[model samples]
Target: MRSRLALPIALIAAVSVAATACQSSSGKSSSDAAAKDAPKAASSVADYNPQPYDNIKDGGTYTTAGTFDDQGNPFNVNATLTASRVWSWYNADAITYSPTGEVQYNPDYYSDVKVSVEGGHQKVVLTINPKAVFNDGTPIDWTAIEATWKANNGSDKAYSASTTAGYDGITSVEKGVDAKQAVITFKGVDASWSSLFTTFLHPKAATVDNFNQAYVKKAHPEWGAGPYTVGSWDEHSGNITFVRNPKWWGKKGKLDKRVYVNLESAAAVNAFKNGQLDYTSAVDAESLKQIKGLAGTEIRSGGSPFEYSLNFNTKSPILSEKAVRQAIQESVDRPQIAKIQFQGLDYKEPLPGSAVLHSFQKGYQDNVSAVLKYAPDEARKTLDAAGWKPGSDGVRVKDGKKLEVGYTLLGDDALGKATAGALTAMLKQIGVRLVIKKADDADFSKILSERNFDLFLSGNRSMDPFAARYLCDFYCSDHDSNITGSGTPELNKEITATTEIADLDAQNAAVNEVEQKALQEYAFLPLFSGPSTYGVKKGLANVGATIFYSPLPETIGWQK
Candidate 1:
């Protein structure tokens, strides 16, 4: 857990207070309150400083802020902060999955090297200016790549998301024809497998008993690979600094060191405003406005295929019945929730693609108009058909059981809590009782892992249409990981058989058929797809943005 300075209660309270204050500041009559209090229109990514690194002066430090605990060891799978930050300091291929889904950064930015893919397998055959060398002067090669895989899989100490993110996968590793080529094999044909590898390649000297122990812990001089190295890591003071990696093989003379301070957004914002931080992260929309108004600071918003949906705990008495679940979904006012949660900046519905990845399949969006619209009357009828009837208190009852269902959500999850609160209000009119139980991140994950919950809420990181593997994992009973506990035996057989089909069209057809089957069963509710939002420092160059939130430091250079 990366330690974060707690935002004073007064500071946290100020956000809601500021929103309320906007009403009075707008100077509109009470009758026009809704219109006057609306959030400001969001700006496009193109409108900001297009070249974030253009004016960046070399040898200076860059700092960003966000919410995380100090215990977040970048070397451990315990928290994303450690692993994510280490990417800028150390080099590796294991756990270094790029969001571009394949090798090479997204076209939105530039990287000299490109990954060539054939036979549905991606290969790093092409080298980009062999100038790419490790911090200890070891040349980056097929050996380095192989060592990374071996250290993570072959060795005893391996750090990965399954261990860190509370799930496991990466089943096998295989080397390609030469040192310059390699292929990672997965136990199953999961689309995410290719994009989740971020293990770093350590110098041969750092290897310990066949394991890369130096990079496995938070020890430094572990061979700085990016533009910076650990200048200071004062855990007691809650500060970490990275000085320029003189050995950084990039187009040098562009930057010196980058400092990473472990602080929450509030302090980070203040530091950036006071000029202590060159780059900062904006935690919410309000902070974005603050960063934009500060001179020489730029904001960028490109995130994962950010999504959220209500997870119906099928174990609940009321929700166990299909009709009751349908009724709850029908009563949700999606547009209203979108307006409040997304502040009207994002589209209110899922885009034309599978819920797993962020790409459109022609005509997919055209078929979703009816599945998501609000239909209270239909909801009531569905509940009625499911044997639930209104009682004296106007609450629904089935077989002498009241149609009251409890929901568990993350307490610190602002968006989820807001959405659940909205659902609570909406369901009240339909005679359904909803109880919200607050759980910390650990408790929530425990429930999910145990398949325990009346209803759950969460988000997806990608959005590719026909992401058949995702549907199978979430809706197939045979996949023990599916949380809903509602998959049928027949569905599992169909999912497995479809995997063997070789033809692309035939595979897609099979996937769509599976999706329809899952939808009919209400395995999961589809939610809106929205662009990720980020706040960046102005003049930082070559920081290519992708659908996944990983940074491209190799392509980034300071201009000033």
Candidate 2:
């Protein structure tokens, strides 16, 4: 069996937060009781197990809520969460990450995978299953590996990959011991080799134009190779239906079909209440209220390896000063923000202290306690010391400039609005004006890609427990995802060093060092860490809120 890895942070942003209101039979709030009964923060992968795949009954269509309105090309960096979910359902990777964070070969895609260092060069060999073929009848082979490498290695400016972190280190990719094998060589030792190939594109669609625009408003089922295929997509109704793929070489999936319904959080909650959705992640108080006593529904909650924070654009004139950034970081009360955002949800989180590793993960440390403590007075003092004094309007002014910051809100969702409002009110206490900038719903991805804001509220969920997998793209100066523009040469060097470490323990130590420095410098503001809450149909097996294992389509079915 192939271990399913957690979805990337970008994909998690798409489906991690959909839920509806929950109320008891008597119309009373159930949040208080739920909160009291909530389990402790998860410490190991076993804490999040949903249900055994063998116990599920075969053949049923599972309907769920999705966050993206359209499913873009999975290969494109601009691909939405909905696209990723669909892609994962209809694709296989050469290797997969186990819920316990170990790298393992996918029996469905590869026969074997090995990594070694020869002559100071990192080498990876992947043996593909000769019988495996895409829905389009293209045999899975070295060509697909080469295409994935070229498209993501940063060697070609035309390919718009989500991130070039692991692929950028590759020196070459060639045929391995046989036609079904791929031997990839890297410039040096790279620890993120296993993290690549989560999604594969057909060799025919490897061109720059095809990668960037081919699947904009279209999905080609023929190119996908999973147990399920895209059966129909109703753009107007915001529903996508997936049926079993005839060309799939793996065992028949338990569910014959699955449907993803794009909905706003509120509508999703109502849909769940109306028995339209089998599962919905209820993150806010309102959504939690609506699903409390739904028949045959179970609420599953566990720590998520997701980090939500305020990303500061270091290039902004008003925020160029480290003091100003530090002041802003200290002024806003994270506990208060979490409180307001999760109000009535019966959930509260501890202050997060690391950008890379979550508190629930091993080697976790609170490195930002000194700098991140909530202190509006200290923030005012820091601004004053930095030569910013209060003006008649109560906003700080330095050199004839007011201390103002712009924040981009990606959607008009209630949670986002409440977060922005809370942040605006909190910043006002320390003479900082937070200007809320709402991005057009259709242009959200564009605004994010253009890095068009002073402070952007976003989060990334770690797909693997290895923090090194994210160091390059999250903080490296050359990466497109480093919106902060705060990457320093020293920081980059340290982060790069982690990729070269062969031992996991040493690599993690180096990661901790880098995270500490980044947090201390206020590279980004760490908010509280909390678990994702989900209301799942009681008998729906092999699926629920989890950070370790993704709910595999083949294993998802109705419980007998």
RMSD of 1: 8.3
TM-score of each: 0.67, 0.89
User: How well is each residue in 387-423 modelled by candidate 2, as lDDT tens digits?
Assistant: 9999899999988988899988766676778778888
Clashes of 1: 43
Worst 10 residues of 1 by lDDT: 13-22
**Residue 14 alpha-carbon offset, candidate 2, angstroms:** 5.8
Q: In terms of TM-score, which candidate is strongest?
A: 2
The lDDT values for all models are 0.48, 0.70
Residue 7 error for model 1, in Å?
Answer: 20
- Model 1: residues with Cα > 4 Å off, grouped in runs: 1-57, 67-89, 93-239, 244-254, 265-271, 280-285, 301-304, 315-318, 344-353, 359-372, 412-417, 441-444, 463-473, 476-513, 543-551
